[model samples]
Target: MKPQRRLRLGMVGGGEGAFIGAVHRLAARMDDRYELVAGAFSSSLENCQRTGAALWLDPARCYASYQKMAAQEADGIDVVAIVTPNFLHAPVATAFLQAGIHVICDKPLCLNAQQASQLAAVVKQSQCQFILTHNYSAYPLIREARQRVLSGELGEIRFVEVEYLQDWMSELVEQTDNKQASWRGEPAKAGAGCIGDVGTHAWQLASFVSGMLPQSLSAELATVVAGRALDDDVRVTLRYANGARGRLWASQVASGHENSLRLRIYGSEASLEFQQENPNQLWIRPRNAPAYCLTRGSGVLSDEVRTMGRVPAGHPEGYLEGFGQIYREAADQIWAAIDGQPFSGSLLPGIDDGVAGMKFIDAVRHSSMADGKWVDFSAA
Candidate 1:
């Protein structure tokens, strides 16, 4: 294969000091597969120019609005990354997709299923790659877990449990001018607080590893913080078509925890556990046998599993590396299409997964709104 030029990348958001935006930029740069060239980094032209200059970008490429950025960069960039607030995701993504450019979007898809459906149409019409950044599933061990479940190493699945917890929003951080908390505390900008932000992540992780989407759900959403507008705590019970039962709990006011995302899956023959904080290790316990652990880059892992990690054994790679893997995989598919070739099958997620996540979020919201009543997942 001949060497190709780096893909030109643009952004809709991720202004200075924006946490997730910075992470996205870092991830894109990690594999040296893409180059940041233009963006509508902030609504304020001053902020946009400031960010562009700080990143050594050509100031002419920094626009005042996403609409202009999309139109101007349509023929200049290979892809655009959508890292805006929840409410803007759909429109920003639609603009870039309509411009015949690929998209890398931050998750929870959009505000609701309607927006998801609308984007689905745009995605299909454009025939452009739309990658959803469900970065957790890109971790080497997480991929290995998915492979194990697919290979029937876990036998008949019986149960699944997942949770995501964080303590930063335990108080009224929004009132203190905390950017993330400010937008998150408002439903208009955030859609649904903790549930959309992290619960969707837990839901996706469980489905990704277990290879199953639940058939129905009963959910309860609570605003643990006194005056919060949206839920900061969410609990959902899942029933699978194959008789598997699952539970998911996501909370932003969980007191002592910080990014404590965990998943446990139990099957007739074995069970496995993964904790995001302890990302390097995966524990497996087989019935009537000793439990063992698999660490990232472990020599015993299959060659495929080993490729998920960048560095060799004994090197710790977590959050950033996991995100980098997603970007790397996206570059592969994007480049394949650009070269007018049939791409090899890859696990990098796309539109269908995004739609499924939105459906789950909507189902949980509907169930909670109806007093924790069961909602058919099929209807979602």
Candidate 2:
């Protein structure tokens, strides 16, 4: 097969000081798979023009609105990357997908499950790919963990514990005009603060590792910051189909912690633990044997894990690398779809996962608001 060409991409947001936009660009460029040809960087036209200049995009192609960009870039661009706030994800993605372009969207797919379902329907009708950037699932070690659980290496899973904690919003940073914090704390912009922000990551990671969706969930949400509209901390207890139990805690109010995401799964025969801070190692303990440490590129890794591990042993592959893997896989699928060829491999998280995340978010919020009563996640 001939090598596929780079994708022509456009961005919906991620203007000045935007966090995830630059990361998306870096991940796209890391493997030479996508070229950001245009963008509607911000709501402000001036900021959009400035960002377009900085990105060296053509003036005519730089748009001030996603609707205009989608209509115009439909014939030119191959894909659109939506890096906007939570509320904008569904509209932007729907526009691009309706325009017959592939989409690479950030997580917490939309403001709610209703919008997620609408976008999912569009993705199904359009022949374009919709890749969600739940990048942690692309980590080599994470792939290994998923394989172990799926292959019954850990026997029948009985418990799952996952937590994602950060201290960036420990105080009222939004009151001080912090751009990231300002929009994120606003319910209109971010949808659900830390729960929608990081809790989605926790939920996705757990489901990714276990290959099981929660049947029901009971949750508690708290806004520690005075006058904040959304929850800054969330605790959820999940019930799985096979009678397995899980607990998830996601918080931005954990003082002194910075992006601390950890997961542990226990089964009848063995257990596994993975820490995001230490991405390269996986701890495994058998019921009657000594605990073992497995590194990313070790001999114990499966073929699937080794395929995702690009660098040699001892080399650290962090967030950007994992994100890059997702982009690479998406690029492959996009190219295959474009060329009408077979692409016979998984492409990390996609639109289905996005729908699942949004449903999970809705269930969490409903469960919390109902005084921690069990809410059926599958109903969403």
lDDT, candidates in the order shown:
0.92, 0.89
Q: Residue 316 of model 2: what lDDT?
A: 90
Task: Write the residue-wise lDDT of candidate 2 on 1-380 in tens digits.
Answer: 64556789899899988889999999999989888899999988889999999999998888889999999999889999899998899888888889999999998888888888898898999978988999999998888899899989899999999999999988888888688888887788888789889999999999999989989999999998788777899999999999999999999999988999999999999999999999999999999999999998789788867877778899899799988998888988888888898777684788899888888888888888889999988895
Best by lDDT: 1
Global local distance difference test of model 2: 0.89
lDDT of 1 at 261: 99
Model 1 lDDT-worst window of ten: 1-10
Point to the candidate with the largest TM-score.
Answer: 1
- Badly placed stretches (over 4 Å) of model 2 are none
Tens-place lDDT per residue, model 1, 63-87, is 9899998888989999999998999
